[model samples]
Target: MAKKLSRRLQELQQKVEDRTYQPLDALSLLKETATAKFPESAEAHIRLGIDPKYTDQQLRTTVVLPKGTGQIVRVAVIARGEKVNEATNAGADLVGSEELINEIQNGRMDFDRLIATPDVMPQVARLGKLLGPRGLMPSPKGGTVTFDVAQAISEFKAGKLEFRADRTGIVHVMFGRASFSPEDLLVNLKALQETIDRNRPSGAKGRYWRTIYVSATMGPSIQVDVNGLRDTKLAA
Candidate 1:
């Protein structure tokens, strides 16, 4: 049996026409449809032409949203000696070494982002089973594994997002909150588009970009004009 849509969701869906819209117009519609009681997140769903099953075709990287993620990002760090203090001084919400690993093993996931120093990764690797599925594992490519723990914590707290293409060749990311202005959301979306293009896999074939869509967390998806988004240039 198909799950029934909420009355609010049904009404919101009706407002979205079946047509691709310009980036700004799509974002505006996204805002208009975000009528949830709580502040909903603004998200982007992009389909790319690549197969991650092949090593060379994989796409995994991070983008810094200029307007920020519009939520408090709790950061946890697993480090040793000096790096632990560095993480703390940099405003890490939680900091520890072995004890931290043990806590996560016992199912304490209080933080949104986790960072670890390079030297501690071997030990941190033990928690992969617990963290990988939840996207909490510290990865060098994701900029969560570094000796400069302070900088890593600072960047993540300031809206640095790690994203990758799923098995279906689509990238889903939350760029900001629905409470943010459409212009602010557009800035973040543009950054995401540029980042995806910049990190295009060497093995990806023709027509790398398939489609792009944006929506509020509880709202209907709005298709975005791929060509229009690509042609957009923001002022320096």
Candidate 2:
């Protein structure tokens, strides 16, 4: 059965017309429609031409949002000896070696981002069943599996985000909060666009960009003009 839309959501939906909007205009509308009592996150849903099922067409990478993600990102590190201390000194919220793996195996997920050193990855691989579905599986491409644990933790805490095209060839990411100024949001969005373009897969053929949309966490989706977003240049 289809669930009914709330009265507030229904009214908000009416305000959005059936047409695409420029990037800035779409962001402004997204902010305006974010009338929830609490601060809402700004999210982007992008469709791309590449299919992720093929190895050559797969896309997995990270982008650093200049304005920073609105919420605090709790970082966890799984390493041994010196790397463990390195993570702690770099402000890791939780640091452990085998004990950390055991905690996660028993369903103790206390952190938002998990960083595992290269030496401990063999053990970390066993937790894939628990972490993969949640997009928490650390991989070299995502910058999560590395010898440089401290730098990885610092970057993730400072608004660095890992994203990839799903099996359906769509990318979904949270850029910032609705309370942020439209300019800040635009800067982040532009950065995302550049990152995706720069990471275009080898087998991606024909038109790479399909469509782009932005919306507040609970607000109606606002279509962003693809070309307009691509042409947008951030001020130096």
Candidate 3:
């Protein structure tokens, strides 16, 4: 009985590690799932938060998502000088203190999201009301609040995404919609997972990752129970 229970627990844990869902390669599993329209809520999207660990080379990772973020971003910044100019030149929608901070504070602005630099963080606290409730605030965990304004803005326009975990300690993210090709979805899914893994906290409970699942926009949530996810390395 003890052995049986241990095996069952191990099996369940493996599903959490099965972070990738490759449909083309696993047609048998695909047939078991009924297709549906993409979900409208970002709540079902999967995301991983990882620590950069002060590494310089991991600065940027460019990936062409098969399915986009499904939401539009109205980026705002608090930086000045070349950093400010650099963000606007790249086509960010908003770039000034009065325009960005003032509107966010009054709770009268309409924008999808935001990204800020080291110098700009002080301004964001004031706009907490406008951006906070809407889930548009630039957070430390999201990689939006950094000294590197150019990279932040560039990735924002390029669909660089930030995600937070829910009460269940799980993050749902869109790999792609049902209409997307398997390859595109695969690349994106892997990229997002890698970024999250890099952000995992060393001081997490028992094992920082308690659970994981994946679903397409407007699709059912499927837990990943694949080859290697079940076996994870502990932080040194």
Candidate 4:
């Protein structure tokens, strides 16, 4: 284990110095991970896709350095019925109303994230200028439009990050970074992985967690295999 650890460390150091690392082949990617769990020093970004157009089993996960995403999310919740208090108490930037329509008209709405209950969809639907192009508009795919406001707000507060797959079948998330010690990165990664594993949509039709790799901003990719991670992958 020590010998393997030393070799892996040298390889990583060389890669960092040379900066020539590329995406790892499936098996080797997970086998040669940089940490046991993930790093804590860095923030994480999550990507998720809930397509009304597609079935389950098609989700994919790939990691990038948090440094690359360059955005810290500010969450907002549009609440009505009984959800207003729950959302505010959970630390969300919140507003509640049928009159929210008028509030958005003045164009004061500004935030990185948006969530709404079923009751307020019409209000949000009317505010495309305030929430649309910015990707702050919440949707069912992003888990922000739902009957449960409290649950959604807490997820945001806990750094529940999200992303979506593009035309090329790749989804990108920033799971901490190298500036973070291996342990910091590890924890963030675990949080991300478990969240996905537990949230399998009841109707999901394809493979989940298709693939995962960890890389730094402008860094090479390291595929992380949960089971094989340990002495062999750790730095000596």
Candidate 5:
């Protein structure tokens, strides 16, 4: 049976052509095609040429969105002593030491992003079964494990995002809200792309970026013309 699309989605889909578009054009189209009443996020889906089964082929890192994610990120910091105070003073939504870990283990998780100090990892590690599955585990690679709890908390609260390729080698990240100007979205997208490009796996062979698509939270995916997007004139 054919999957049914809503009338709004159907109409929105009509605005997207079958061919790939320039990055800026694709972003503009994504914003134009957003039909959600609430502010929808602009997302990018990149398919890379790599097998995650190989450790060296995995891509996991963080990117600071130039224009912000446009969504408030609730940050949780698990630290002790002065670090806990530092995190709280740095604007962390929730901060605590062992008690916070107990709360999480007991099924109380209210924050979107979780940061922890290096020394507390021994305690936080116990929650791996719960946090790992939710992508909330603090890893040094993700910039969530650090001594400067304040910097980590501030960066996350200021639109830092962690991304990793899934088992299938696809990375989906939110660039900004559909309501943002096309230029803003374009900047954020380019920043994310550059970061991903810089983090390409050394073990990966052949073409790296297989495909790139942009879409709004409730909009149709628009194929991005890779070559055209690389054009200095348009990308600039």
Candidate 6:
């Protein structure tokens, strides 16, 4: 069923134009259209021209936004011995070895991000059934699995995010909150665009970036002009 729109939402929707907007203009308009009582997140939906069936065409990576994500990221680390202390001192929300694993196995998952050291990966492997579908399984590419637990914890807690293309070859990431300044949102959005452009798959053919759109959490999406940043090398 379609949701019932509020008067504020109806009014906000009327201001959006039907044409593609520049990155800066889209961010500015998205903030203006935000009608939610709470601070809504500003997200970007990027469509790519790649086939997910091929392993080489898949894209999965992380980027640390210049302005941190307004939401606090609760991080959990799985390590042993000194590495546990390293994660704890680095401000990890939860740190453990076997006990933490057991807690998760018992259907207790309190943290948003989970990191595991290489040595304890063998033990962490048991939680795959519970974590894999939730995208919480530690992976080296996403920087969620590493020997340097401290660095991983600190980076993740400081707004480092993992983004990967879905089955339809689209990458969705929240750049920042709607309450952020237009310049800040643009900086984060451009950083994400650059990261995706830099990590363009080798098998991708012409027109890598198919479409780009930006919107507030509960507002209408505004199409972004992919060609608008051609001079800055954001051409697709």
Model 4 alpha-carbon miss at residue 51, Å: 12
lDDT of 2 by residue, 66-132 (tens): 9999989999999999998999999999999999999999998989999998899999999999999
Q: How close is candidate 5 to the true structure, as a TM-score?
A: 0.96
| Regions of model 4 farther than 4 Å from truth | 1-73, 98-109, 128-133, 177-179, 194-211, 218-236
TM-score of candidate 4 relative to the true fold: 0.55
**Candidate 5, 135-190: lDDT as tens digits:** 99999999999999888888888889999999999999998999999999988888
Give stretches of model 5 more than 4 Å off. Answer: 232-236
Cα error, residue 157 of model 2, in Å, equals: 0.5
| Candidate 1, superposed: residue stretches over 4 Å from native | none
RMSD of model 6 against the true structure: 2.6
Per-residue lDDT of model 4, residues 1-236, tens digit only: 54343554556545443222222232233233444344322322223334424555345332232223224556777777567777777777756666655766677666666788877787678887666666567778677787787777666655555555544444565654445445545555555556566655555555544445555543345445434332123233
RMSD in angstroms between candidate 2 and the native structure over all alpha carbons: 0.8
What is the model-wide C-alpha lDDT for candidate 1? Answer: 0.94
Q: What is the lDDT of residue 223 in candidate 1?
A: 99
**TM-score of candidate 1 versus the correct structure, residues matched by position:** 0.98
Instruction: Give residue 163's error in model 4 in angstroms.
Output: 2.8
Q: State the displacement of the C-alpha of residue 78, model 6, in Å, after optimal TM-score superposition.
A: 0.3
lDDT of each: 0.94, 0.94, 0.53, 0.54, 0.91, 0.89
Residue 17 CA displacement from its true place in model 4, Å? 8.9
TM-score of each: 0.98, 0.98, 0.63, 0.55, 0.96, 0.94
- For residue 222, what is the lDDT in candidate 6? 90
Q: Which lDDT value does model 2 have at 203?
A: 99
Q: Please, what are the lDDT tens digits per residue for candidate 1 over residues 46-147?
A: 999999899989999999999999999999999999888888899999999999999988999999999999899999999999899989999999999999
Best by lDDT: 2
